[model samples]
Target: MKINFQGAEIHYSIAGEGEATVMLHGFLESSEIWEEFLPEFSRYGKIITVDLPGHGRSGCLDEIHSMDLMAEVVLEVMKTTGVKKANFIGHSMGGYVGLAFLEKHPGMLQDFMLLNSTPQADSEEKKEIRDRSVELVKRNKPAYVTMAINNLLSPKNTGKFSEEIEILKERALKFPTRGITAALEGMKIRTNKTEVLKSFSGNKILVAGRQDPLVNIKELKQLAEESGCGFISFSGGHLSYIENKVQFIKLCISSKK
Candidate 1:
């Protein structure tokens, strides 16, 4: 179903009949990424997936969809659905939004997991890259999307997951160029939230991809240790859930407790 928040229509889906579990998709991705696992996940609890502000069936909100703005959307969605507290799982950009949620509603998180994501803000180098990306997308969206999806998977597994990558690219291509650029702008300016994660005493986890080109594994592991959150590693790239589905599912189920 869809709801209006801040004058923008947001798309979301909820299934099952127990505790709430919110799954937020990453940049260039929609809630569709979680559709395959809905049946199994819903069996464990009420699973909620959102298209966010500018992806999937959701309408774009602003030229810059800031993390806090996205988090507010999540908050409003939860209120509309009568979810007071829920387990949160975020992938990539979705993780930044999740951390914002943790900060905004500390009492509302039963558990949280960062999948192939981090709590750190974009570095200066990354910011420059994002700026370039915004301009590039405006000029050639498909080219960037295709290249990005290609590089997201480990080189070793690219051939093995070629079909899946193509599907991802197809979906990404459908996302509005404005929305894509807005997300990039938002991610570029996000604040560091490592301290926020450190203070949470709930069942928090950080699933890292050893081969992830985007995240710094060494720093992430250190963050996990310093924050006292559970750490799990996969031999894949940024899209750990796709690169390592079986292990990802097992970890998700175990976190349901």
Candidate 2:
């Protein structure tokens, strides 16, 4: 269904009942990524899947120019859907959005599951990468974004699952250029949330790919270790959840219970 927020429409889906679980997809992806796994998760509790502004069916947002704005969009979704609190699961850029949400709206989340994402801000090199990405996107649409994402996974993952990777690439190609611009801009300017991680009070799980280059696995481990949160790993790269979804779902359900 569509929920009107700030003149833009956010599309979302709801399934089952019990404590709420919100599934947030990464940049250039939509709520549809959860289709294969949401059914299994629904057996555990209420599942809410949302299309963040500029992604999926949630079309063109007027004011969503930062990660903080993305978080506000999520809060707006929760309010519109009548979810007072929820357990949040986010991957990649979605994790950044989740962090922004937690920083701005603390009491609204019961617990969090960060999948293949980091709370650290961009380093100079990372900033340069994001800057180049912005220029590349402007010059050639989503080709750069898709190519960058493909590189985030292992060779085996891509070679064996070429079709899946191609599908994601195609879907990503449809992402609004302006929206991608907004998201990249957010990444460039976002502050480090390491302090926010320390302040987190709820049950948390940090899931990472053993080969993820975008997010340092050691840093992820340090965050989980320091925060006393559970840390789980898979054999793939940045898109570990998609590559190894069985373990991903297991971690999500197990963490909730």
Candidate 1 stretches greater than 4 Å from native: none
Each model's backbone clash number: 0, 0
Report each candidate's C-alpha RMSD, comma-separated, in the order given: 0.8, 1.5
Task: Identify the runs in model 2 with alpha carbons over 4 angstroms from their true place.
Answer: 62-64
* Local accuracy of candidate 1 as per-residue lDDT tens digits, 49-108: 999988999999999999999999999999999999999999999999999999989999
Give the lowest summed-lDDT range of ten residues in model 1. Answer: 248-257
| lDDT for residue 236 in candidate 1, whole number 0-100 | 90
Give Cα distance to truth, residue 232, candidate 2, Å: 1.3
> Which tens-of-lDDT digit does each residue in 11-46 have in candidate 2?
899998999988899877889888888778999999
Residue 136 of model 2: what lDDT?
92
Cα displacement (angstroms), candidate 1, residue 71, comes to 0.4
Which candidate leads the pack in TM-score?
A: 1
User: Would you list the C-alpha lDDT of every candidate in the order shown?
Assistant: 0.93, 0.84
Pairs of residues clashing in candidate 2: none
TM-score of model 1 vs. true structure: 0.99
